[model samples]
Target: MVSKKQRLASVDALRGFDMFWIIGGEALFLPLFALTGWSVFHFGHGQMQHTQWHGFSFYDLIFPLFIFLSGVTLGLANKSLRGLPVSDRAPVYRKAVKRLFLLILLGVVYNHGWGSGIPADLGEVRYASVLARIGFAWFFAAMIVWHCTLRTQSVIAVTILLGYWLLQTLFGNLTPEGSVNAWVDQHVLPGITYQNRAYDPEGVLSTIPAIANALGGVFAGRWLAHHSGDHKAILKGLFMAATVSLLAGFLWHWVYPVNKELWTSSFVLITCGCCLLLLGIFYLVVDVWHWKRFTYIFSVIGCNAILVYLGTSLVNWQYSSKSLFGGIAAALPQQAAGTFLIACGVILLQWLVLRFLYKRGIFISP
Candidate 1:
């Protein structure tokens, strides 16, 4: 068996697997339906995109999965920190605060930077971002784990989800212009909404429920860490929790609807369910069955996911792919095949870059 560090491989692999879609791999499927003209490809391609409103899709699950994974890691991180003397806690707290602001700063630059003319375009830029949401939600969840027991943390998560549901149901109008979400963004944030027009998918009020998603991840991490020895027990509990979460989400969906943009309570439950199920499968395979070799590629990407993601955005891998391999892809007869080839080449190029870093034992992380 591997050491304590190796135990984290499953988590890292799972995280990388999720990041695959975000890092251009999802584009690989866009043209697949065109080439095959099969119902399966068409259905999958549709699921790959976000639903316009009030529905579930595979694409909708990616962001929340990141939040959930952070929560899981936080449980492990907090447990280690708890062992330190009280005097040592302050520095860790300070570091976390620094990391928080750094993430917020990065989010700011990502939305409005030198490319967008900096401060001149800041007023119209979408300030709220996926990174900002992850930072905020994970920061709060980390703080909560430092002080609260597992039971208390779980209670807090449930309360947030249920409370948010009640509030939205009572006051939410469920319209683009009239919904409480849009009203708050337009009223409080003004032009800072996504597209600098109306509402942000990762708006302020919606983050309250998002915190619950992270908390659910914390619970998963805690359970896994606690049962690290009894493999059978760990699998059983994970599967059971996944089932319960799935059932609760669908039951609540009738009233609240699983809306990703809103990050609805039901959406939280369902996505967490999917993450749990995925993690359970990964754990059983990599950790129990000892199928470690196949997951190494994912582990490489997951080790520095944040850095690679930011790098992709700043470097504009799309431009690189177009410049370097565009002709190669263009040779294909089917446009769908051509598009899929471009996406494949791009992702493969990214993997090669990441692989080089892995071989050199270099990783950029925050």
Candidate 2:
């Protein structure tokens, strides 16, 4: 049994694990080829990248995994909100909205600054974004938790998935450029998109099932919350829920096809299953078994994820790393080896920055 004040190390470790890949994780894989000289590993590299048009990949899981974590944190942190008076809850709701707006603003700035979300004389603004997707899912899932019981929340999640599946089958084509998702983005967003794609992968219509993914996390979070202090119960429930979701996701995939671009129903289930298992693993190693040292660096990054996420964009570790590593890159036998050296520098720079903050006990939260 865990104490009330004892934070769950697994959650922070998992979140940090996700953020690790987000900033420079992929670059590490490219450079690893220099060590093993296995050209076949390029196949593994391809898995790290997105699955192009119609399938799933490791890269695809990253964003949704983070979203699931957000819900889990929301569940863990906001358990008090469930019993709060309606009037008193206003402030909490405001905080959630503020976080959403800030994410949207930052997302716009990340995309195009002040001129974002509107059409330009040249390239269109990409109003849809990674942060925006998380923001929306977080906001909606938070609201459902505030207003409903765990059982009702489950019903809402199912309805969202089922409703989305029916809408897509009845009307959506589920393709890249010509699907109903594309049609929605075109009609709603018009020219604003990512790289002139016909439809934004994180578009409006797909947000429905995206919410379900978070709710799935919420359900997991709620389960953990209920079983707090009971290690065996928590682990058992986590495995049980994950197994059901895994089977459900694969079974539905035959019909809906687990597509990240569309945030398909099966994708949500499968990803949540993966996320649950990951949470289980971290819990087993870090919390239950007390393998704290193993996750120390990840926890460092996880503790201040928002800081690293925003900092990586402005820091430009890659560019600065090049000043010293240019010669090494040029001298390496394989291009991937050189690329790896530079990535190591960038990753090291980011880690040092994170480590400094961590040492000082400075953590930036929403």
Candidate 3:
């Protein structure tokens, strides 16, 4: 069996790698690209920000990948739960539910909470977001993993993906222009009417396929746990997952298109395939090869991911830059210097928070 130490390192490494984009991608890389005379809207990186209505980008992949990872972790936890006595399962299940709810609430609060000072209008608030979707998917995936055996879970996963495709294609209402995404978005999601007028980021219909993404991870997690210490077995499982998922995604894309917005089955498969490939690489290097030191920085952020994310969102660390380092940058008369300094300050603050949490043994999950 893979030791707990090995598992922790793998999970933390993956988690940290994911967060690196969130923390630094927007503030650092894109700006750097612009400074290098790349127009923000000229090429792929602009597309990376978001598609206006429909399409996919590297940025779009990040959330689904994380949700898939959540499923993997859930599967691992479920395996641990199974070995416990019957009496212990209920409490564990309850804990899982609590965590899921907390994630959803946090997502909501982060977007719309009065603290952010954003308007309270539901339409304006980003109710349907990556975090919220992850929360919901994680909860649903957890329930399935908790209740079903690994074999049964696989059956459920396939069923959901296929069933969602059928529903979207066959029964969906026709948009004014007869678009599939709009039609499904209108008919399926509750408490909100789907209109061709505006695209809802967290539309109701998309969650069905998003769950499939999580389930894919669940399958991966189950396989990993079962194979544990067998490196060849793990590698084979990863390859199989990547190969099947890519094929399925490509095949389905012929009909549905690999859309991140729709969270289409094909998109799920493709993203999950990518995620599995990434996890495989990380596993090989960190787990099998033991390249331990470099991952420590990311591991720190990954360990307290939620806390760091919330802190960055809530507190304006940029003010510190303006107050402390902004004058120095101003003296240099470099236009981008202030922005760079502010970003550096934000990074420093986040690192300090993560380090403090790490020292305190206070890792926040969910």
Candidate 4:
């Protein structure tokens, strides 16, 4: 039996796999497409990019996947906290709020607000951001988990999804300009809207549904925690849950559509289904079957996921890659090959830094 205190390798590997793309794993296939001119590579490359306005892509899964994983981690971390005396829970709540604000601050910096230099005015800053959304989603989801029972949590998830759907239906449409998300950002949200557009992808109104995504993860986490000793049961339960979620998502898509920018309710259900499905597969392969060798790199990156994310923005990896692998890229036969080499170099350097931190038992959580 796995100890309750033990971390799950599959979770880390899944997170690392998601982070892989954000840190340029998506570009890894673009050169292959350029070199081979094959449909498969072209298709793969396309999947790596976001859908411009509406529709789904492999890339759209990346952000929500991380947010779901954050909820999973939160659910797991709070298992012990939940058992503590009521008075002892204060620290946990404090820590949760602190992490939320810290992530918001980091999100601003990640957007180059403070990192680039002080903005001329508050309006110059783009406050709605990827990290900020994660913060809000995880924070509210954590609050739900901390106070509610499994049944209550599930009900709340449904309520939030339905409520969000209703709100969007009444106030928003699926266009970049007409999106309720865009409207809220432009009129209500502080700081300039993302790219000075009508809407920010990570804007305020859309986060309502995103909290449901995190709650889905919380549910998954609580389930795993409840059944830690039975791997087979866990596998069966996850697969079955995923099947239902996916079915519901597809059915709902006929009405709501799976729009990533708006983060439609259907998008939440579909992505959470994917997340659960992926978690189950990873659990079966890595945790249940004990096939650990190939996933080592992902696990390494996963252990220090936050550090690498912040590092990519804070550090000049492109310059470093060019310094180290410029000659190699220059020596390549084709421009595509050179571009691919440099992309790989950038990923390699980041992975090496993550590996160093992982080896030294250093992990940045926030």
Best by the lDDT measure: 4
Task: Give lDDT tens digits, candidate 1, residues 185-216.
Answer: 87776336776546788788888898998998
lDDT of every predicted structure (CA atoms): 0.80, 0.81, 0.71, 0.84
Best by TM-score: 4
Q: Name the runs in model 3 displaced over 4 angstroms.
A: 1-6, 34-44, 78-87, 114-127, 173-199, 331-334
Q: What lDDT tens digits, residue by residue, belong to model 2 across residues 16-78?
A: 898888678777765676678688667667778987766788888898998898888767754
Q: lDDT per residue, candidate 4, 1-366, as tens digits?
A: 123475688899999988998787888788988988898989998899888865789899999999898878766654544566878898878888998899888888888883245545776788888888999998888788777777888899999889988888888678888777877888889887667788888888998889988988877876777788799889988899899998999999998899898898999999999999999998888888878874788998887887778887889988998999999899988999999988999899999888888889887887
Runs with alpha carbons beyond 4 Å of true place in candidate 4:
1-6, 77-86, 114-120
- CA error at residue 272 for candidate 2, angstroms: 0.5
Among all windows of 10 consecutive residues in model 4, the one with the lowest summed lDDT is 114-123
CA shift at 138, candidate 1, in angstroms?
0.7
Q: What are the clashing pairs of model 4? A: none
TM-score of 1: 0.92
Model 4 TM: 0.94
